[model samples]
Target: MQADITVDTKGMACPMPIVKAKKALDNLEPGQIMEVVSTDKGSVNDFQAWVKQTNHELVHYVEENGVFTFYVKKQ
Candidate 1:
């Protein structure tokens, strides 16, 4: 999906991806979307849980070749 902003946490480990995502998400409008690209395997769980605790929408996610791409919509 298209995003208003994109943040790549490609070699980052735990917390960093979420950290960047949170910072990036802050720049987005309430209904805008942010795309996050992560190479950290644990980010899948982290993103899912993080979105659950936040006022954002997990639009969707995809995984390929150990890369995890997540789309989140600000709410």
Candidate 2:
């Protein structure tokens, strides 16, 4: 349940969070976890859809206050 890499996109919206997550994920080896922190509510669906379209895995996600944290595992 630990991320190998973590990126904070707390102030970013939509594609920016995804963009940064993609870039950060690129640095990870297969099976590594990437944690993305964002404040954008829409990213809940964005990350879900993005993972489905790619070879990665959306391991888990959580919402704390107004912050959204996504745990994605690279494939």
Candidate 3:
């Protein structure tokens, strides 16, 4: 899926990925998509919980090699 913004947190650890994602998402308009690429394994659960708590939509996510990619739509 294409995104209005893409945040690459490839080498970041735990909270950093979520933190960067939050900042990127904040700059997007409602219904716009934000794509996050991270190497942090914790991002799986982190993004899930963050989306739930923020009422955003986790449009899709996939893992390739060791990188995780997520598409989130702002609500």
Candidate 4:
């Protein structure tokens, strides 16, 4: 999916991905999408739970060569 903003959290660990995602999401308007590229393996589950709790939509995600790319749309 296309995103209005993209945040690269590659090489960062744990909370950092979520932290950057939160900040990026904060800057977006409702209905805007944010793309996050993270190298942390745990980010898959973390982003899923975070989006559920925050009421955002996890548009989709893909893993290639250990890099996980997530597309989230703000509600």
Per-candidate alpha-carbon RMSD to the true structure = 0.7, 0.9, 0.7, 0.7
lDDT of 2 by residue, 1-75 (tens): 688999999989888999999999989999899999999998788788998899788899889999999999999
Worst 10 residues of 3 by lDDT: 42-51
Badly placed stretches (over 4 Å) of model 1 are: none
Per-model tally of clashing residue pairs? 0, 0, 0, 0
Cα displacement (Å) at residue 25, model 3:
0.6
Worst 10 residues of 2 by lDDT: 42-51
Candidate 4, 1-75: lDDT as tens digits: 778999999999988999999999999999999999999997789789999999999998999999999999999
| Ten contiguous residues with the weakest lDDT in model 4 | 42-51
| lDDT agreement with native, every candidate | 0.91, 0.91, 0.93, 0.93
Estimate the lDDT of model 2. 0.91
* lDDT, candidate 3, 1-75, per-residue tens: 878999999999989999999999999999999999999997789789999899999999999999999999999
TM-score of each candidate structure, all chains considered together: 0.95, 0.93, 0.96, 0.96
Q: On a 0 to 100 scale, what is the lDDT of residue 35 in model 3?
A: 96
Better of 2 and 3 by TM-score: 3
